[model samples]
Target: MHDERLANLLGAMALAIHDVMLPAVVDSSGVGVSASAALVVLGAHPGLSVSELGRRLGLSQPAAARMVDSLQEQGLVTRRKGTGRVVHVGSTRRGREATRRLLAARSAQLVDVLGSLTARQKQQLEPLLGTLLTALYRQIGDAERVCRLCHRSCCVQDALCPVGQAERSLAGG
Candidate 1:
């Protein structure tokens, strides 16, 4: 049975967390949300083409190019010609540093919010969140886009990421 109250509470919680988190993420990187996400993505998977980056970020090719231009101007990223006409994007040292700071800020904000819960509640909440994330991945069908801003290493420290697990399951692997 669909619980309207549960749905409403979850929606409110998501918005509340975004409200507190986005600013810290943006401020840490001194960039917009999308740009910060791009940095994080590049930090994890460097040397991606702008098109690939756009696909992960759910952005248009032109928009991704423009963003790369902006990052290059800020000395946060560098672009190099690939095998053919493709241009690959990678973060500079400054960009990597920015990504670290952005991730740290994001973690701090979430930690603050999670601090409100008791230890037992947090332990209980973890699996529930993983279930939700897996459901979301199934619905979205794109793990990279779904986890564009995620700290990938942390999520898989002890177990496979739920989204990744969902993706593999869908692929019958």
Candidate 2:
């Protein structure tokens, strides 16, 4: 019974992310899903090294570097000198604006899809989603990768962030 429920939930999440979120953001922002994901991560955690960015995006080092180059060319990101030959990447103002627009569009799409749900149903879904996200973050063990495309504004305050709390618990904090 649990397995069936898990499978169904996973399927729904996959469809919502791949089908609904990606297409809407693409249409509105003219950014591919991967690039937008990268932007979202950078927006959330600035000054990440290229390797870290690549890790978050599940890209190889070379591929990550190339993506950073692309982002730099588009004026969406900037690279700054970090300690001891490390280059840290950060989103430019343009990148932040783009990310904001993409997230807004994504939220609008989600609202449209869930608009029929009663307020009570929406309230009930929040805790369930948080629990699921926390569990998934624990299993994945990589916060940036897991949350690369998440809209930070929707996250419960930092104190209550599921992924953040999951990570802290794992760290024995």
lDDT of each: 0.94, 0.85
- Name the regions of candidate 2 deviating beyond 4 angstroms: 1-6, 9-13, 157-159
Model 1 — which ten-residue stretch has the worst lDDT?
Answer: 146-155
TM-score to native of every candidate shown: 0.97, 0.88
Tens digits of lDDT, candidate 1, 18-80:
999999999999999999999999998999999999989999999999999999999999999
Q: Pick the candidate with the highest TM-score.
A: 1
| Prediction-by-prediction clash tally | 0, 0
- Candidate 1 has a TM-score of 0.97
How many clashing residue pairs are found in candidate 1?
0
Q: Over 4 Å off in model 1, which ranges? A: none
How many residue pairs in model 2 have overlapping backbones? 0
